[model samples]
Target: MSSPRRVTLSPTSSAASSAGFGAGSFVVGSLGGGSSFSIRSTLSARACLDCFSPSVSAMGAPPAPRQHQSEPATRQSVQSPPIATTAVFSALVERAQTQYAKSGDRYIGYRVLGDGPIDLLALNNGSNIWIDRDDEPHWAHFDRRLSSFTRLIRFDPSGVGLSDPLGAGELPTVELWTQDALAVLNAVESEHAALLGVSDGGPVAMLLSAMYPERISALVLMNSSARIARDDDYPCGIPQHLLDRFVNTVSDPTGGEDRVDDLALLAPSLAGDPEFQLWWKTAGERSAGPTTAKALDTLATAFDVRGILPLIRVPTLVMYRLDHPFLRPGHAHYLAEHVAGAKLVELPGRDHLAYVGETEPLLDEIEEFLTGTRGGSDTERVLATILFTDIVDSTKRASTAGDRLWREQLDNHDRMAARQLQRFGGRQVKSTGDGLLATFDGPARAIQCGLAMCDGARQLGMDVRVGIHTGEVERRGTDIAGIGVHIASRVQACAEPGEVWVSRTLTDLLAGSAVTFADRGDHTLKGVPGTWQLFKVEG
Candidate 1:
């Protein structure tokens, strides 16, 4: 193997800049021998990989990314929110619009999110879908952490999810999957990127890295292996009889009806959780059908990337949970030993899935490996829905009623609000003088509570304006503070008298709920960084 030649990709087009990618040069390299050259070229009118033009140079090491951090927050009251169902979560967090990358005659579905410096392409195991990912909080949080340090690209492999399914009698292969990945890369004009492969997706990442070293900057393999099936020389692989049994299980025509066994093997920690089980069954069925699942599984058993493992020349990180039943520590050991300069990190857990159990430690390792910093902070942050309510014209109402009468009205209002908060499972953060601030685990509950406040206020001969927004809030002891808190406050200020107004984030989470919303249009919230789309909760 020759010294890997470096390639530099510069995004000079206005379209690229507008898409949140900064204008600059980034280094990447190929393992194969190639003379260094520079060319400013636009992609031709191809059916599949149409996108911006990119200028390439000899690949080299990528630049270090800038440090990113969350804002500090003060806390007043704290309580954990209840676990929500998938139907509610899907609408809570907004989704990235799905786009297609043409690979040969077939279309590959992909989506881009975050604007971090490095482009990290997530190659999921064939059984997962991008749209269904938001259904789980852990998975969504994992993606957000990755995106916080890199521009995250997620896509469906050929014949899975939103991508065109494989033809009848056709089989899936690593080479074909590699093409699907490359098409997505071209579609986004990302000449260089780090690859994060989970489960069976790891083999494809290894092959792509070895085959086109210039395009790959780094490789991270999580709970994956070079080859899965056992043979005489590879005693660590799954035995033939067990592999056959697993294949037969997935090929069952009953589909998602009985996935408990599958969930147990994949994520034992979450197997007992009914909500997680429902999401697993639904996401699996939506991800791939019985035939496709079997095909992917059959192909996976045949995957043997050991021959190309030594050919990989880029920075590599091999991560595996120590007790993952099937993936096991041996696979990570094999990968770390074979791949040159590979760093192996063993995490302690029983779940094979990356999103299950304690995930922050895994995320912490990946962040430190890629960015040279753990970026840990003193304050804790979590995803939550913030609710702000204010009594309309409080001063005037007080003047009309006098101090004693106004005090009585305030007491009645507080009692009413407390009852609604308790009923909805919300924690009141503090009193906002004329109103109150609270937080909920789910947006649907927050909105419902806000509406309850409005109705309760009307009974007290007072009007109340309520606002709600969902985002990452910083926990500071007994209070919560962050940009998320500020956004909710501004949203409340924008509400009309006796109306319950919510940020678009709230409405998205409540999409399939019985509640309906009328668009209040986009407004530039005071103290907030961007123009937020607001909506009114219909009575």
Candidate 2:
């Protein structure tokens, strides 16, 4: 009897979770005439589906079946809007045309959304910019906001998205992707423009700014890191153990689920929303298949740009969520510290996916950084929700666990706390050793995260207390310091073990949420002028 034919997927990196054969090696078994080719037959049946798939659209048209040709560069004139209104903005992108930019032997996909005063080139993190257009509400909102003051240009890297695909097994490198970006700029006839790099695109933007300073007016990096692998000098990179798991997930057949999981981590605030999750899943499937995603993941893991930070000459802004699950604030801090004159703006949210959650704050910061104004205004004060959490009887727990074990537990606790904050779209302001202070755009999420943190602490054999307040806060550089902070801290102090307390302001704001609260009566808060009413969240 002959052995059965088995297909095996293997890892391509030494840091791969499983120990296996060398990279890029695929082993296949020969089949006899008597043997049935089920896999091939199945694929043949799906050929029709593949032929009409919307994902294969290139240059604004469905690709010809089994045909390969270079798309010529094209452009469309977009009227500069005094301010991008909803109706005008919707019409612009809907009517916008996809163009081709020649780079090397391949053509890259590019699009122009506006023709405002400044030219802006947006680099997506290893995804199709055309797919982003399908996310009309989010993408349109972003484009409209940006186009109000600048000409917004977006493009897909070669071999990804709507751009020309690479030859079989061909993977793009940072240098190649950067060249594609430059080609897009050339095709658009943009002499100079500001660059906005989100996530993986950060390194490409950095490289472009460093190599072609004259072509870049400024640079903005969002939820990105300089390096992705942990080392002796770079501790912020994902650990080998985590990287291995990530690689396996990316290569799995159900990697679409992994992508959704990633979206959850990157945009926890929107993960539970059906509309957002559907959009994310559809976008991911349309962006790339498992093999391509795995290849991109491998390339990103090896990406390191620490050496080039100092070489950048353009004015730079590094913005990150303090509680981002994938990239930590330290990564942004590192960029700001090394890049001369670079300003770091730590926004209040955990979503690494730019379009989800509280994106207005990020856009405000970016607009102000790039154009010296925010939404064409100068005001910085904005409405915000504050959350404060502290460990109950933490001093005694530390004494019981001892120094070494307690330190480990504390580290775990901090990680858990940050995840909870990220889940609720909260921005971690600072850690108070035994607790954390964070800010949010809405009070409902703050209350929900506080409840989750309490539950999580209980799972770790610990007790926690939480407090929430809603008020206006002043935005400072990478931090928020105002009376709101003091009120939140005092509110937390009133909470008992395993209890979540909130000010009347927060309760009022959470009017429609399922959350319920019991009146805690009025009390005087220290260092504050008036007496305040408080409430305890009820299950």
Candidate 3:
């Protein structure tokens, strides 16, 4: 007898928690008799319901689904550990779009997202362009939430992801890192912006704020210290010998298992997750080589920004996790005491990473501190542009091609769809037999994605019809529902094979945009109230 088919669904957000897989990584549902396909999320975490219905497995076996863990729901963000297939994980990384900034002979990589009033620049440790990919669902949500209130700017320093690497044995000083931040700010033409310094990035922020007081509006530090190494004055800092050992372990490429074990200490919340351990090792290796990582660590050990604390003239807020082993409570208190009029809020958690362990509380404090008001709770409904596609003559083609060939075609189609979805920033809702259902924050992106999907299908010897509509949709846990979804599916039915169709609502929204449409005349949609105007996308 063949083994039972298994479907694994992991939650990427609080919204996706209901379908189980709360702490799991990417979404992969591979069945036996039918076909297997991967799932994708949006720029932010929208509800992702596992939409696969396994009657028979794609591997020609019987269908059976199993959950990875029955643990209570833990809000898993991109900051959570990854428990996904390599293909799915790589697809997540492909979503990142890094822009370059010139800093003398070196080029710094940066990304600018959102258009909030205040420009908030993020100074993260070796995770500038890499972290922005939303590899973890909640990480994406965290960024989106920040963008909702502030114009968020994130960049990688020298010797980090997408940035110019340092020469052999060349270590970066805090001043050099400060210049890297300045170059990013100038690249975006940001005259003044708030700075968000996380972990080691705190010292850089403090240094920048102190030197360029006129250019910085405010400062916020999280799970970071003014001085990482212990001295006579600050006895609470990590001991030099212990710091050296920690740095060695983290920078040793061969000691991946040690890093994996230590990652649990860094993020105890994800300690038991096997997938997270795999992702941590993979991420470390990809972000930087062992030599560069060691050099960066050695530089961090010398980071002492306490002298500059009093020089910082901008409003400052210092926050730290109370129980973090490496970054003890004393560091936060010292920062608050030294930085003039700085407010210190002690957070309750052992997880050293800022995004893990009760992120909302940290976000709440940040929002209030920066925006002067705490925003409302996560919304259950949002405005979205829904896209629906259908494969023309799929059933007949499947029968003629046989199951093996048909499954291969389906897998190829799945990958093609994932690429397009990532390209256009569309979130995959679910698979509808031969086609797909997805949503985008903007109608133009949705339209472009639909066209791209249709073109890609043609290359695979298939014809796909697409329909798009923009309206408010109710978030029903991992699944989305409401009239908007129904209308989009219905609009897709109006399209001829290989044609892209859209409701008048979507076309109206896209007015003055680059996308052009031809009038298909007004027609009565099935199971709908009034007459609807539809349009076919012009090539």
Pick by TM-score: which candidate is best? Answer: 1
RMSD of each: 23.5, 23.8, 25.4
lDDT of 1: 0.64
TM-score of 2: 0.52
Q: In terms of TM-score, how similar is model 3 to the real structure? A: 0.51
- lDDT (Cα, tens digit) per residue for candidate 1, span 330-359: 677788888776766666676767766756
Kindly give the stretch of ten consecutive residues in candidate 2 with the minimal lDDT sum.
29-38
Overall lDDT per candidate, in order of appearance:
0.64, 0.62, 0.62
Candidate 2, which segments miss by more than 4 Å at Cα? 1-89, 126-128, 254-260, 373-539
Task: Give the TM-score of each candidate.
Answer: 0.53, 0.52, 0.51
How accurate locally is residue 396 in candidate 3, as Cα lDDT from 0 to 100? 97
| 1-539: candidate 3 lDDT, tens digit per residue | 11212122222222211111122111100000000000110111011001101101110011222222222222223434433333443433444357988865699997766555556677655555565235654456556666655556777777777789876555666655766777777776665545667776777677666555555556777777877776788877766765665566556655433232355445668655665545555555666666666666666665665644655656677777666655666788788778766766766677766665667656665655554421121244455678998889889999999999999999999899999999987889899879888987556667778889889999999999999986657778767998879889999999988888998765543432345789999888888888899999995
Candidate 2: tens digits of C-alpha lDDT, residues 1-539: 11212112111111111111111101010001000000101112122222212222210111222211122112222222132344656566675688898987898887777655555677664444563454546656656776655556777776567888877756656656767777777776665546677776777777666655555666777777777666788766666655655555534554233222454445567556676556555665666666666666655655676755666656666777766655655677788788876666666666666765556666655555554421111135444678999999989999998999999988988999989987877899889999998987456668889999999999988988998876646679878877878898899999889999998765543432346799999889999889999999995
* Candidate 2, residue 92: lDDT: 69
Choose 1 or 3, whichever is better by TM-score: 1
